[model samples]
Target chain A: MHDERMISFMFDTNLTKHLAELSKINFTDDEIAVISNEMSEIISLMDTVTEYNIDETFASADPVQFSDLRKDEIKDSFPREEILKNAKGKSDTCFKVPKVV
Target chain B: MNDLLKCTVKELSNKLNKKQISAVELTDAYLKRINEVDGKVNSYITVCNEQARISAEKAQKIIDAGSANALTGIPMSIKDNICTKDIRTTCASKMLEDFNPIYNATVINRLNDNNIVMLGKTNMDEFAMGGSSQTSFFGGVKNPYNTECVTGGSSGGSAASVAANLCAASLGSDTGGSVRQPAAFCGVTGLKPTYGAVSRYGLIAFASSLDQIGPVARSAEDCGIILSAIAGRDENDGTIKNIDKADYCSKIGMSMKGIRIGIPKEFFGDGIDSEVRQAVMNAAKEYEKMGCILEEVTMPSLKYAVASYYLISSAEAASNLSRFDGIKYGYRSENGNTYEEIIKNTRHEGFGAEVKRRIMLGNYALSSGYYDAYYNKAVKIRGKIKAEYDEIFKTCDCILTPTAPSVAYKIGALENDPVKMYSADICTVTVNIAGLPAISTPCGYSSNNMPIGMSIVGNSLREATIIAVADAFEKQFETKEASI
Candidate 1:
């Protein structure tokens, strides 16, 4: 826990390229280094939770109960114009896309 | 009445009934306090003064006519994660920094139904990830006591606001001690009820299976009262059932004669600071004097709690956050080629680094090759953890441990280490993983006078018994006072 290099261990970039690809956000190596540094601090602060004597009495994930989530029934639908007003990009009566379309 | 703003809901309700203080005046007083102190704490993200004034005006009429609800005009703050219809529901992240929910969360609806004076929304960790409240896009919340030490988080702002008397009681979401841990840092009582005891209809998803909303207040009684109003079944939250809610304030000052409490040996070992452990031991002795019997219990599988919790929570967080494609209300990059392009651009631009890390970890854990070993194995181990708790419950009514290994550290204590920060949840995450009830009540203070909490847990849906044990313990301790 006392190693000075432990601080640098957080920015290992082990997951950087992979995560960037998945999340679609590209990160400069400097940005990755910064994120890793901050992450290391957060991880160290949370080290306390790992010390518990959970003694096999751990619980499972919460179970799903009866959800009133209704089927996708469109009621009182808003006009496309109103909804698209807040959209970053839109096309003729629908959302616009880049050349890939 | 300067004292009116400090009174608990129980006290305020009694005074309101006796006409010693009017609800409208009480509401105005808290609004004034928020105005005076909000700048220092950065606790509130929004102030619903218009709705508060309107609610207070109506409460005055009800009181004048001699008919009003118990919580009428009682000021309460809410976490930023809960939606309030057109009000900013930032989750303290720049991602949805300006996105507004089209509807209110059921808990918000329930509180409104009780006529609670909406004080405003409190800040939290960005997307409820960070523990020190440092991750908020709005800025970090300072501890009311010193402003140098952190107010433990992701619910840090709610705990700080309540500790500082900016509001009577505030509601916070606890995925894993989010409410209770912060309560300890700020010297307040926080309850994370049994997973399904309170509805999660409006809470923004972190790990949907783990998040539960609860109350943070100055006393166990206050937490109970707020819990009573906020508990019960909600059709909107399908995961919740039609369970009966007990009168939370009904059992206060009650005898703890036959209650059997188990003290887990693992919580008090070498890593816990001496002062923090001493505070908990002192609390245990105090509980012993309160006519309850204490027994030693051990759950050996808990050593892996941190490893198990991270695998599952991070995995779930990744899946839940997948819905935030830039196509929606959140930040979206201008890049759009294929459908995949929009997702990558939006997520890359919208989510911060920590979030991206978790999402990638989750995607990998749940990925084809790693699913069985990482995710499935963790789930199986989770069952073992649950089994151990189940075995112990057969012998005792509840369990007790330190809410955190120690008191709040400086702002940057673990800012460089994500895993270390995640480990802080080790002592508290078991209860969340188990889907049980737990509370963090102020037990004692550190040499520096920072608050320490005693975590009390009980069986599934056993809110009544859990609060009863905590109530008995809280009543006997005088150091339970908040530093502010």
Candidate 2:
């Protein structure tokens, strides 16, 4: 059990950019380099979790019973105007966004 | 400092009930204190002066009719992340700089029922991400004890306000030591209630599984008073437990004789500062004098708690924050032709560096190829951590340790090293990972005059016992007042 091989992850600017794209956040080349360096430190920190091979199943700390959930009955919600009050671009009763082809 | 401002919530409640002070006068005193001290403290993002005055007037009317509760006329600060109806709740980000919620959070509604006077929304780390509160778009919050030092965050302003007497008490959310660490650094009391003890209906979720609303106040009893007002099951929040609300302050001043308190040896190793360790040990001696028994115990999984915590929290944060695209209620970029471009541009412009970093890390951890190594492993380790804690609680009534590795340092001390900043949270994150109730109260001050805190952790849903232990210590402890 002590002679286990751990998967090595290669972190670089390309990987950082790929992650940023997946996250839907943009970053400059210089910013990506910085983030790449920072993420390496964080990844090394997280490697401790992989160092131990625990033989246990994952259980939630606070498990919610299915029956304990609130009843799925019809209820009053916020009005359209109240919900849309904070929108930057709003039409008559709905939020407006740029045209997506 | 005004004597009225120095009164704790219980003392002020008694004074209000006895007609010795009117609610308006108490509110004005706090508002005046904020006006004089907040410039240097930078604790508040928005001071609701007119709204506070109006609420105070109404509260006074309720008191006149002899229907006031402990918090009825108490002026308190709300962290910026909590939604307040008709008031701007920014989460200290540019994305929600001008966005005002049309509905109050369930906690806000509960507090309103008690006739709570809203002083203002306090500053915090942007989206409750950073530890120093420096990532806030508004500005960083300074320690009231020393303006150059940081108020440990992401609930920095909430603790700083209570320490500086800007308000009687304040509410702060704890994802991973946000409330307790800041309370430790700022020399006040903070309580992180058991998971599902308080509702999270309108809290801006960083990690839904770890976040719980707690109180930052000058005394543990004051925290209990606030907790009683806010804790209970709510239909709006599904995560809350369906249990009767217990009086958290009911056991204060209880005897500590023969209580078995566990001192985990892993928490006091080489990483802890010597002075901080000494202060906590001194606090243990005090408890010993109070007839409590100290037992040395060990928990091996505490070494991996930070890694497990960050992996899970950041992953949840990534998913929760995806809803803030250009289409909804947050900030929208001005220049983007297509919908996809618009969403990307808005996120790029709206989020701070720390928030973006977490998003990137979250995506990396949850990627298809790495999920088993990172996120899944973290969940398994989380289970192990909970198991280790359960073993200790079988014999120990409560656990004792330092709230932070060290006292607060100067701002920008760990700015360039994010790993170092994250590592400092080791002392406080384990309790959150295990979903237990804990309280951080001032134990002693450092040689440099900075305050140190010690935590008393109880079993899940055992808030009253821990609060009782903390209140007992605070009864004889000499707390230093910040001369802001």
Candidate 3:
């Protein structure tokens, strides 16, 4: 149902820029073309969701509810050294981050 | 005996209990097998030869003390995504190539408690993203049955290792059929328990709502043995249900009489290969001959399952994967000066094409203007689909369908075509969306001698029923084991 012109239009619109900014990843022009074509195809397939009219009260699937939560109690946590083992920039006892203005 | 590698978990346990074969011997046999065929199969990312030997020694002591558990001496592989303390848990991505978790996943803790010997970490689709193992930065996992074909993924390596006798059983995380489809392609039995059935505390998140850690083994009984050890309420994972421990192994030989099996009409429609359809239909017939009832059920929302699954899973993935920046625990980029630029460059260089495409799609759907149109609508439709399944379950105990639309395609058959790759998950994704338990067991073989799998889906937490039906059906077929 989607045409090439519309696909290009969707790509040219803020869609590409917004996605790049949102995901914090840049793409080449050719990459954009390929991604745009794929996105357009996926969007057309996803259009089927719009065909069904869901009730306003319809709730998403929640197999386990929070009411099943165990009583909150003080418990042991992972050791501090172990927790910081994967930190890229870390001091002896704290994680180091970039300076903010 | 070198043939000990081909025995089931039960057989291995019995042999260990009788002192016929020591755990060290079994571990050595599997290690030898890995050294032999892993060059062509490439099922393992890391072979824990030394660790397995140590565990096997400990297990031999346990057996000597007369305290051997069902899987005490069993040598198995863990999917690379599962964190094992001091061992690298690369999700087959360059991002975490050097990263090692300080703690083991909760399932790993249980396996250790049972004295199960771990052979190694199996390869997988990078961050469990792709349908075929081709997306792994390590390399594609080949099908044991046909070396030219792919082992369906992202749990392809786990299934392949089990099929090729690289290990007795293995654990894999299923998010959108990662466990089931690959098990089918490799002719192994794989179960994806209910979303909260197994604790997900230490699993590297891939669509957390749908992710579950389950077992892949030679038979449903082995899956049950592994599941019993792993399934229970964990205080660390609040999503775990507080139910009594299920005796999954006891349900294997149970009668299938008077059980109702629903065959979804939509699952057999267009896009399914005629061979797969025939095989699944033949499985249903076998169930009927075992005195089970087969009813054709209609779930119209299934037509939208692939779309809904992609949207919802990608949205969750976008949020879940946001933590993997250059700041913590993964690949860092030296090309950028600023923090933001460094993060962006790191992600761009580290992620595979499929991962990047999914992140882009997810961000696009969750972007400001499109959230309501794409993500929200997809969630609503997901609710409708779940509701339809709920209604169907009232009339039937479980549902049956082909695990995948076709047998394993060639290694590069769908490399360039991403949408077609997503379509291959059509028959298996609905169970994940519904948060139900399902098992993929080899039902028959295709004309090419590749294995065909059928999925037996049950309602939430109904793993016992699903496994029982799968065991019954699998026993009816004389499926050819893959000879590597």
**In what order do the candidates fall by DockQ, top score first?**
2, 3, 1
Q: Where in model 3 is the C-alpha error above 4 Å?
A: A1-9, A55-57
lDDT of 1 by residue, A3-87 (tens): 3223324435765566556655667688777655554453443232333323333333334456455466657765666556545
Q: Tell me how candidate 1 scores on lDDT.
A: 0.78
In the order shown, the chain A TM-scores of the predictions are 0.60, 0.80, 0.67
lDDT of 2 by residue, B122-235 (tens): 999999997888889999999998999999999999999999999999999999999999999999999999888899888989998888999999999999999999999898
Query: Per-residue lDDT for B1-484 in model 3, tens only?
Result: 3778888999999999999999999899999989989989999999999999999999999999999889998999999999999999999999898888988899999999999999999999999998899899899899999989999999999999999999999999998999999999999999999988899989999888789999999999899999999998887787887767778877778888989999999999888999999999988988999999999998988888888889888888888888888676778777676788778888888888888878887887787766776788878877877889999999999999999999999989999988788888899888888889999999889899999999999998888888888888777678797868
lDDT of 3 by residue, A1-101 (tens): 43322332365425765686788776666877777777777676666666666775546565544327777888888798887788777888886656644
Model 2 segments beyond 4 Å from truth? A1-9, A57-67
Give each prediction's DockQ, rounded to 2 decimals: 0.26, 0.62, 0.50
lDDT, candidate 3, residue B166? 96
Ranked by lDDT, top first: 2, 3, 1
Better candidate number, 1 or 3, judged by DockQ: 3
Report every candidate's CA lDDT. Answer: 0.78, 0.90, 0.88
Q: Compute each candidate's TM-score over C-alphas.
A: 0.89, 0.98, 0.96
Per-model chain B TM-scores are: 0.96, 0.99, 0.99
Tens digit per residue, CA lDDT, model 1, B279-386: 888888887887778999997767767767777777889878977876646667766667787777677777776677677666655766446545666666677777
Model 3 interface DockQ: 0.50
